[model samples]
Target: MRDLQADLAICEAATPGPIQMKPCACGRCNQFLLSITHADGRFDPENAKFIVEAREGWPEAIQRALKAEAEVVTLTNQLYNCGKAVFERDQARQERDNAEDKVDRLEDELRMLQDALNQRYQP
Candidate 1:
């Protein structure tokens, strides 16, 4: 599986803006085709022609892609930091529990020894 962070980093570093658009015409029908040229120089669906559903979506798609990429990056960082904090907290809790268990064991031994001494003195 491709890492999204790496892909986004590469995209942001290499291509810093929206994909270019070129107004083209259909070869067979001589009809106008709205073409979207990506930063990678690849045309959008070369086989299928776009009839310009909405010019708004062209730029909107770019903005959405950029926004989505940023959101993913932010969420990924949050998840990593949260996971590390949870692991640290769990480790600290385990250590405290282990220490308490050791102290309880020592206290029980001391109580046993004191009780034996008291019985001997009474008798």
Candidate 2:
């Protein structure tokens, strides 16, 4: 039960291409996690340990969370703009083709009219 458009909006709303991120060892925040055991250079699935130093400055953590929320919003906006532009471009192309078809029809009609005039005036 996931909204597909909302999912795609995450990237289109952000930028033209995919989002890039720097890899982290053990997925540890440097400000947090004084030490990480095993040094796997990646997040450990089984032997993961996160030791909280202190909870004195929860506001800073909250701010970090909000920053992540802002990133999501920015990404969604990018996707929305990209999708809109694509839609508009498609519409424009369709309109142009329709106009071209109309011009072709008019040209054919003019040719028919010229042929009729010639037949009527021919000796």
Q: In model 2, which runs have C-alpha deviations exceeding 4 angstroms? A: 1-52, 56-60
lDDT of 1 by residue, 30-118 (tens): 43322344444454442122323223434655777798999999999999999999999999999999999999999999999999999
All candidates' lDDT scores?
0.62, 0.58
RMSD of 2: 16.5
Candidate 1 residues lying further than 4 Å off, grouped into runs, are: 1-56, 119-123
lDDT string for model 2 (72-98, tens) is 999999999999999999999999999
Best by TM-score: 2
By lDDT, who's the top model here? Answer: 1
